[model samples]
Target: MTETGDLSTAGAQNGHSCCAPATSRAEAVDSHVSHPGADPAVNSESEPEFSFDFVTAGGTFDMGDPFGDGHPADGEGPRHRVNLTEFEIATTSVTNDDFARFVADTGFVTTAERLGTSAVFAMLLETNPGAEAHILGQAPGVPWWVEVSGANWAAPEGPGSTIDNRRDHPVVHISWDDAQAYCAWSGTRLPSEAEWELAARGGLKGRRYPWGNRLLTDGEWNCNIWQGEFPRTNTLDDGFIGTAPARHFAPNGLGLFNTVGNVWEWCADWFTRDYYQHSPQSDPQGPDIGDKRIMRGGSFLCHDSYCNRYRVAARSSNTPDSSASNIGFRAVRKAH
Candidate 1:
């Protein structure tokens, strides 16, 4: 959606990209809900929008880690710096109630409900492969991923899944389109990758996690990242197993919550692992055209043994139309 590319050359607008080509996870997957009674149809013209409170981050901030950890993905490399002008961003992610308000007014259907099923990390699936299966499959990760039947955002595990117990929790199973629709309906927008990292830092540098370099300073959980042993069990030391409220953990230096873990927050730009190779010193939003969109802030599923993408700089991508019960979004009121 970035419409500010260089226009020097005669055909630069549509010219071949000078940056490395981005992988193709940009395709939007449809998770339309056709259930008996759910949300109404949502399109570009929905109205009665919503509003959010945001914080403006100005000046430069260190965007990457000072020390390397396990399983640093390819895109995290060439650690760089960025100097952003003032921009206000929501302090918390979009909540279920917030999205509910959008649905109540505009009748928006999330991508998960639309798909009937979505790609869920296999580790989250209770199925042990010997259980009943329907198009069940796994993606290559530590615990592996499963495309379980009926695993949409509502029922994270499938037909039996639901968001009923989780109200204060952030709404998962949203696709890029779903998030964009909610943002539009609410009069907000998704944060650019840089803006997100800046807000997440809360004005801290060289810190491993959002609150600080330490996961726990005074024998307490600062963020809603994974807890207990990986894959097998969770102690819920952070007062949550799957997910907590958007404000469950302590806010970072900038007063943002869950910037490290909870659910992957969608960004405005398309995914590009190597885009940082040529990242501009000022607000680099990423490549113009690509398949997959960028997702940051790992989820409750993140563990050091497997997917520890919860780090401040760690990144991953998913198809625009693909929605996961572990995926949700936050919005940024435009800075004027």
Candidate 2:
């Protein structure tokens, strides 16, 4: 695996190879597109209410990579014990339907919407006719990521794409700031990196996946992920080429769905590679400050040959304002 002195900084500078493209706000603004008005059907006052099924999680568990398979630069090592107080995490990532309600209620414009473009996987553009017209350019070094105008949460692939049929899928093209806005509207908060891992483990201990160390359970795929050669062909072995329905897979032991796949969920804490070395034994809240926020759980694009960050302990990060097709988030709250 290629190692950068600072993983998040490298991602911001040249985009992640196997995950979301990291386009800075200024980069996106240079190729701005007119912000289309919100869809009346989704932004109307009569939109349905949004709710989340949260599972209670807490207690002491080992955090970090037990298998030592993580990239050293990503800081998934020095496995250590951590104690966490009770907290509740959503069973699945926040979906388009959920985010639409937040937008409808508050009329908040996402960072992507304001910047006027978002990064999309170039492979998706191949299947979408006329999408190439919206392409601003490829992310530097990573040609697979196509920066597209009008590619916000509402129009995931570009101007003509819509989330109308993907209401159940996790809302992609979401920046950390976008998630924070949603959390504020919902009276919830993003999970800390520690809290996120604890909940993702689902009452398990030192396992590669939430279900166990094995990638497949009982000869069946347990999660959605890249099934074939990297950046080329996908066999659709897990039945999805992109983001799957947020709640599609079997729930983990603690009843969390798609904990390590589907989309990379943003965490509340800022990222630092060596934070684990100095992390507190209880309730580690990450570094005091940093340029990027932590992102956990690999997305549908993750493949073992390239980016195998789907492991429970694996972590990555991007700039707070960066938005991409493979990134999304879930909310957390104190357990009463």
TM-score of each: 0.78, 0.89
RMSD of 1: 9.8
Q: Candidate 2's residue-wise lDDT over 33-96, tens digit each?
A: 1111111123334524555598899899999998878887789879999998888889999999
Poorest 10 consecutive residues by lDDT, candidate 2: 31-40
Instruction: Please give the RMSD of candidate 2 to the true structure.
Output: 7.0
Q: What lDDT is obtained when candidate 1 is compared to the true structure?
A: 0.64
Q: Kindly list the per-residue Cα lDDT of model 1 for residues 1-336, writing each as its tens digit.
A: 111111111111221110011111323343342221112243436454333357777688777656776234437766788887677788888877777777777766765564444655554555334323643444323223445566655566666556777766888778788888876666667777888888887777867778777777899877776677765667878877666888877788777888878888988777666887888888676776676677888887777765666778777776676566578888875467
Model 1 compared with the native: what TM-score? 0.78
**Regions more than 4 Å wrong, model 2:** 1-9, 12-17, 27-48
Q: Give the candidate number with the greatest lDDT.
A: 2
